[model samples]
Target: MDVLSDVMTVLRTGRPFAARFAKSGPWSDHRIGRPNGFGVQLMVRGTAVAVTEGGETYKLGPGDALLVPHGAAHLVADSPDTPPGPRCEPGHAFPGAVLRSDDPEATHVILCLAYELAPNRNHPLIATLPDFVHIPADPGERPGLAGAIAMLDGELASEQRGGDTLVPALLDAVLMYLLRALLGPRTVECRFAGWATALADKAVGPALEAIHAAPARQWTVASLGEVAGLSRSAFAKRFTELVGQPPLAYLTSWRLTMAARLLADTEAPLASIARQVGYGSEFAFAAAFKRDFGTPPGQFRKQAPACDPGAEPFRREAVAV
Candidate 1:
């Protein structure tokens, strides 16, 4: 699998949720958040302003999308001066309910998609991202979002055969298209570097894919360089410059992350887990795990929270909206 898809698969902690919301009149709403989740809000119609708790403000219009990878708290309103309205918490919204205002005139529509991610594991690829990724509909930058939104709304309303399975897949596709544009060659966000640049680089991209594909492989700097089709020293320099870590250092960190996920989500024995992450023995793996996680593997598993995807509804969390 590719780097983004692999990380997304390992990070998911619960099922995906999709909903469409309609609001009218002058309004401001602070939406609730999922503890370990990623959220994407696409402006379907009308205009609004987004104010993050960090004081970052965004003006949004039709076809624009905001991606909250770590569930940052934010408020959306008809205008910045609009009085902050009631908090938009869960259950306050029904499948197709209209969030009305003082006067039911002028409608603003938005499509919301959320993905529950694991709290225990943190991938550097995701860690390097900013709090929000805004893919504005800068003319040709993002196309066909309206069509995707219509399909999503229809799939949910119809609930025909296989809708349950199809809805999630559609949700994933919608997000993928938005993100694919984010990683496009023409993405000109000057502030985005590190992992984003490395992911798009021809040399570094292949090396990352190799590491994720086979974490247990006995990889040396020279071997990884060969995989990247670059000389050893050149690859080493470029990888560190773009990725912000030496190749082996990144490998060790990723190995520990994958090990932690296995510890929390699976019941495999310690020895088996050790070998899977490239440790020659259980004792060595335990030491590395403890160093990174501040707890031994056995204890971490014992203290692991209920991470089952069907465990329960999302707990309330906010960043500052």
Candidate 2:
């Protein structure tokens, strides 16, 4: 897997819900924000407005999309001056909802999605992104984005074969498309210190690939610098500037993240998991794990239920379409 793929794999993803609806009258939705959630809004057929609590406003038109990576309190309405409307119900009320307005002369179709984003570690991928990311109406347009959203709609409307398995995968695909749109190739314009700049950078991208590819390897900054074809001092400076962490620091975090994922999903003993993630002894790994995750390896493993990727997705614990 590549760097983003590795991060996505390491992080734990929970149930995701989506709703598409059409409205024609004066309508607005107020959001208090989900500090632990990620949200997406797409203007499917007409116009809408998004405003942050800090008074920043963005006008979204057809084909435009916005991502609230760390759900911030905001308002989405037909116009900026529109008054706040009633708060929405929980995720259970979102799926397959076709809320319409009283009037039928005009129409504004929108797609709203919510995802439970829980990270096992301090992932920079989510940490360093801005408060909101808005992909222009036609900036690097992707035909597959709408298709992915439509697939989610189809699944929600009527569960298809492997719906449990397919829904989460579709959510991941839609999110990736949004992210890729945000981080266009080497010419990306976002002022991101994380994956956007790091992955596109020539010197740091290769080093990141090496660290993610072989976390078990005993890596030093010098070795990583050699891989980047730069001197140790030069590479360290550039890598820190772009990636928000030194090469060795990043390597350690990746190693621990892999260990946490292994504990969550596998039945391997501590010794085996430790060795696979570059720790020498079970005792040493336990100390490091406690320092980082605030819990011992045994307790963490016991508390975390296995979430196998290839297995069935989340059970509808009071969830309904």
Candidate 3:
């Protein structure tokens, strides 16, 4: 998989999130889509039938996580053995409804929620993983996941906090935990290994940290090599092998990424934004921004929609650059 060069951080618009419970009696079928945005669904308890984007079907169980990456449509049901019957009418007080099941006597509750994922280009993790990520239960580490389920159950079962305020928060936390279990080790190692991660090399931590800490600073092969404690020539060779680009080239690209974020979010003056991002003047910043993004900063922001207040800007600095 090319050892993956980026990560994805979802941006939220400060919109309140919600979750609901569906009562299923023997026969129940439902469809889910990304009407609001991307989200993760944790099957806290019981087994459900899942049909993914490509029409592949699988039985999802407790502790399993369904990560809908690109807002593709999916179907989750109590049974795949039979077609669906009458759906519970809308405005039924809950997010889901009950249908007749094969058992005719067995009853189950399916928990669901709609959430927003922050957007960022620097991280490519979201596109790398499967549309649905299923996490297996760890008998020893059940407390955390189980507690998340409990919170969801309570939020849906009771009318506390004026609505289901806690379910989304709980689900988001649960997804983070699941991700930690799946990618935690790699992320930790990558941090110590440094920008070589982005460059696909090793022993580049100091350089990565320095670049991230001060994207606007003027940097060169000699200065970065000094930070890496290597001679300029040796550093240049090793850096190219890992980062896939010359030092000055990488620095320029990084600076442009920062400028993009500032333009997209803040209403800062052009000169000020340029200065903040290390450009010597407004003209220099605009030239670079135009070259990188295909338009000037002012024009880019004008064409773009108002960003989510809660969303972190699209700058590389906001992510692990």
Highest TM-score against the true fold, candidate: 2
TM-score, every prediction: 0.82, 0.85, 0.63
lDDT of 2 by residue, 104-137 (tens): 2447766777765554565777888877888866
Candidate 1 structure, TM-score to reference: 0.82
lDDT of 3 by residue, 50-100 (tens): 676577877767656665555556666667765654332211232222111
Report the candidate with higher lDDT, 1 versus 3: 1
Model 3 misplacement above 4 A: 1-17, 25-37, 82-122, 142-149, 156-159, 162-172, 187-213, 219-261, 306-321
Candidate 3 weakest ten by summed lDDT: 312-321
Q: List the residue pairs that clash in candidate 2.
A: none
lDDT (10s digit) by residue, model 1, range 34-153: 556677887877988888887799888888888888777788888899988777643323321212212124477666677766677666666777888888875454555556666775
Candidate 1 local lDDT, residue 302: 88
Q: Which ten residues in a row have the lowest lDDT in candidate 2?
A: 95-104
Candidate 3 TM-score versus the reference: 0.63
